[model samples]
Target: MPSALVFFTELSDAPSKAQRELLTLAASIGEPTVAVASEVPEAAVTQLGAYGVNKLLVAPANESSFLDHSLSALEAAVKESAAQVVVVANDNFSREVAARIAVRVDGSIVTDAIDISADLVVTKDELAGSYSAQAQASGGVLFVTLKPNSIEDTPQAQAVSVSVEELAVSAATAPSVRIMATEEKVASDRPKLTEARVVVAGGRGVNGDFSAVEALADALGGAVGASRAATDAGWISHDAQIGQTGVTVSPQLFISAGISGAIQQKAGMQTSKCIIAINKDVDAPVFEIADFGIVGDLDKVLPQAAEEIRRRQA
Candidate 1:
């Protein structure tokens, strides 16, 4: 096995838990080398070595107005390395980038992989983590994007000089699409919804009231999420939506409040380590997968739960 290229957006600093997990997966198939479009800081080198990365392939951040420059650089790195396996974090931008690289190299690509073997067999979750699907690439390179938090970051201490290599790449003539403008989202102190270990989510049973949901989430010191029905009703923003059309979250402990737990909703959060569902309807679909089910109206149950959580802290 040759070196495995781990594509990333940010590596000027330490690798995120997701990126570290990518390295862990890469190490299983081959020597894990980081491929980034950003300048690598000396401090980041030390961090990369902790995760068994001996080499870094960095393409200077693109200056052109075009968005394909970064993708082009990643594709070139994959070609230059000629690694049979490429690993990236499963996200919108990274998946798109991986797809392009797969096409350029005529490789087989798999996304949302939960586990991968050294032989390049990939294990993926389908139907919202309900069913398991495994695939083996017979020829060419194998590109894989792993779901966040699918694996824990375990550091492997190794001795080596960090060698940063310049990866040469030619940008494509024109991008298929371009962004006219960008809006910066307001920053928050809450943990990002996808990365949080604990998450509290609400659904249609709340009936447009997120007061209890937000309060309970705050009390638990976790991120808040909403079902598609809650978002469709305009109770919360689309970014907070947790379902098939929204983001997939695998938190350690997921508390689903007022959510009906349909197959669509389960697709987003079925991988949670433990689930507790609070709903007035015992017959609701949510109870099917709940580790603990509470039969009560969320309006009353949530406030009491929040109060109890706050009291424990006090």
Candidate 2:
């Protein structure tokens, strides 16, 4: 069997859902090995073994930026393992690293792949989920960036023992840039926007208040999202924006409140398994694609829905 390499910029105490998915997919393809820039926490190492990762490669701590270190580690791992298949998370930074790796290794790179078969055929959705496409690298190493939430992580029946390896990051691979300072973001209990199974989004209809949208999202234990209009209006941070120009999400459930359901926004989240739209306008475009629709003011509708959900839970 070929050797498959999975690369991550950081490893938390426990492997994240996306990380587990990547490991599982790599195991399915071949002998699964993981390369991370930071030291792997003991919990993460054990969980990686559960996902069938037998080899763990750690890059030496360096003064370079996280991205630079990640690039050096991944490049070294690919060469050391002669990995025929490399998997990465589909994010801006990872995509940049994947692109560089492709250029350096003379490999073909594919992004946003939802599935990869044992034979290395990659499957992905195209044209806003209106079409599905399968792609195969003609030859050489195949580098793929998988979309989050696209695959389910299933642990091995029994855990495999992990062998740790230290990677030597050459000076040439390290960039001249260095980090100056860093500040931690305000912590929130909500799940990440991309990885959340449920999302509640607000738009212009919320006027300037997100209390109702947030209440519903909190009640459902989901992440909060906002349309471009709301973000542009300073109602929420750009990080919460969900649309073509922002984050793309494919959650199991997506609720849109006060959003117009423009094509740009649809392009980001149309792949969601279920969508519910709430708006006062009877002919809103969001209603066109929503599995369920409510033609009522979101201010009143959202709070009521939230209360009902909380009540049922209790």
- Clash totals in order: 1, 0
Model 2: residue 28 alpha-carbon error in angstroms: 2.1
Give TM per candidate: 0.91, 0.96
lDDT of each residue in 1-314, candidate 1, tens digit only: 65688888667476666777888878767778788876778888888877777788888776553358668877878877777788988888888888887887888899989888877789998877778899998778888999877777777756456678988877567766566777778987777898777899999988988989888888877899999999999999999999888999988889999898888898889988899999998899989999999999899999999999999999
The parts of candidate 2 lying over 4 Å away from their true place are none
| Total residue pair clashes for candidate 2 | 0
Best by TM-score: 2
How far is 39's C-alpha from truth in model 1 (Å)? 2.3
Query: Residue 224: error of model 2 in Å?
Result: 0.7
lDDT, candidates in the order shown:
0.84, 0.90
| TM-score attained by model 2 | 0.96
| Candidate 1, lDDT over the whole model | 0.84
